[model samples]
Target: MTAEVPTTPPGDAAATREASERGGLPGAVDPPAGGGEAHAASDSALARVVREESGRIVAALTASLGNLDLAEESVAEAVEEALREWRVRGIPPRPGAWLTQAARHNALDRMRRDRRYREKLALLAGATVPTAGEVDERLPLIFGCCHPALSPDAQLALTLRAVCGLTTAQIARATLASATAVGQRIVRAKRKIGAAGIPIRIPEGDDRADRLDLVLTVVSVMYSEAHLVAGRDAAADRDLADDALWLSGVVAAALPREAEAHGLHALLLFHRAREGARAVDGELVLLGDQDRGRWDAALLSEAHRTLESAARLRRSGRWQLHAAIAACHADASSSAATDWLQVLTLYDMLLRYDRSPVVRLNRAVALAAVEGPVEALAEVDSLESALAGYHLWHAVRAHLLRLLGRDAEATAADLRALDLTDNQAERRLIVARLAR
Candidate 1:
């Protein structure tokens, strides 16, 4: 999620401000707040704090309140309160604890104010504030959001918004949906959870297997989005990818028998091991062009071991196929030495599991390497209707066209690819290719 938290809605502004003045932060503050400059600084600091600590704060609130919607609303109120109160009184020494406490207070207030939550009032009243150890409630929240009862769309939207703390727009962009659609999906999902009384706790046994698929999907989506970062705030992108990586590792540890979990961990590790070579001199580097020497050998080895372990569980999935493909690249001495036939075989298996246009496009590239441009061009052309708006599709078509000595068509395809993307690094690479 971006560091910038949207301002509180108008209805909650007064309540949040009131909550702030009533000792929201850790330190006691005298009334009569500071000037506008101090307010601005506090707002900036609050944004940073929220971005860094939002997951833990929201997790704790959800665990205590047992309502995803209430937890989110209360956390928003607490953050709004922090923006105002921290301006007058400097940020608390224990910011996470302060946010948790403030959120807890808001949750209690919500319970008392709303008749529907009267029953939960007793629960809220007895809820003890978590210390340093109990703050990480994200895993529980993840399981709750991805419950089997909810549709896949609901699972994805809720997990991204609630567990990952991503904004609607970020979720929309990552999932290729309109922001309004994503927001509506989240709202509906939360409503269903509340109406159905879905407990906000980790599932056990067979229930865990059902939910594990959804959890792996969420993590995989996050990891894939990292590749599209295109040098736009590389540090933030890396942090997000690392978060996905960490989450996958946690899943693998949690479910030792789930082969897909280990497979996902392996897949993410392979991708992460090559992150350094994805860009050079501020230009996006294609996988074939990336410097293999820059890849992390330790990570590569771990990926191999993890994939092997997953294979032994007698399970096969898209993640396992992807990891195998990555291993093929990692084991190659250079691009020229890459096992295109083996890579093509992996893509074929992946296509059976996932026939999305993007997968087809990638498989076409492998086909070009293994068969010939003529056959690959046929496959690419068939996907035009499905992937016309995807920049990478056009870019791949352009590469195939160039290989076939169709310079004019290749140039047109390259221009179309450039028009589809606003990412600066991507633009540079496409422009350089056009120049050639």
Candidate 2:
């Protein structure tokens, strides 16, 4: 029997709702039939199906179009064609090969239409057509789209659009931004790439290492965002988390010597294990409150194995320490049994490596666990100036203050956090905590 193909449409409320139900992993949610549901399925399939055959699709399109911009456009057009054609004919047996051919044809037609495209067309026409196995060559495209030259936000947006096949609206929703804003960012990034004549080839040596850091950062951000809302969204739409892991794993596989790459992969794996127990009955469950048994044991074991390997390398990077800290929590049978002192030590090491306001905020949480709320409150106060607009800073402060019997201050801080955060779920959690 043939394996069933999973698909979902972009921006369909029901599709998004279903995707959310599946933990936000794209292509995991089945598209509803007709009434625009099929289209939603197609959209979801377009964004995520590429993952299954990413190497073949990317290699073929890149080889055909020469230019990354044109190649991306052709690929998107091909996916659209599939949506229209597949509804009646049904999905082909060799979908990736079909997409590759369709995209190639689309690019050839575009080149034929452009008067100034002769040189590029000739270059593409002379190039050997890529086979499915050659899709690994497109890994360079991933690095190029997520180049360090671009802003972190732009790198992520471009990577999702070019590498992951996400629509601007989907990208915006994933990042909690307006679609128009994401669209503008993508346009600007593409324009910059064009104007700068940025080569699509992957970097080498030191330059490659630098670019890899940026790529890993983008992936880390996506994983963190997905983890934050794991309970709120369906499992299938949880692609952000999986995409992050996939990209990080790719980087780790490609650059085995890079300790940071391994560190990042371990960090994501560790966090993902806790995703299952993050919420109960649609309400957010604090780490302290979550049942340990609810956590995915296989994922947790994988995370520990990765963390152990990362530790054996003996490179004390931020991600490594973070993963170690997460592993400590994973080892505990209950929240009260957590080794807060060890967690605090890891946080100290992490702070030494990177002293961002965000890291400091997390350290404060650990401090609260180990040194008491009063000490944690002091640590938080130190971060107030730097993290003035950050909601979590205020939220942490409120929690600490409330524990210290300062109800008035706790209420005020909670209100400030509510005003600052845009996430409805997070805001709701903060409000409920304040009410308590």
lDDT of 1 by residue, 1-436 (tens): 0000001000021222223324243232433554656665665566555545666666666777778888888888888677667776888888777877888888888888889889878877777655535434578889999887898988998887777666665566566677789878988999999889888888899998788877887887766655454325222256567778988898888778899999999988987888788766555677777788999999999999999999999989887887898899899988889899998999899888878776777788788889988999999899889778767778888888888999999999999988976667778778877887
Instruction: Enumerate clash totals for all models, in the order shown.
Output: 0, 27
- Model 1 RMSD in Å is 7.0
Steric clash pairs (candidate 1): none
- Tens-digit per-residue lDDT, 210-274, candidate 2: 67766666566555545333233323336656766777787778877777788888877876777
Best-fitting candidate, scored by lDDT? 1
| Top-TM-score structure, candidate number | 1
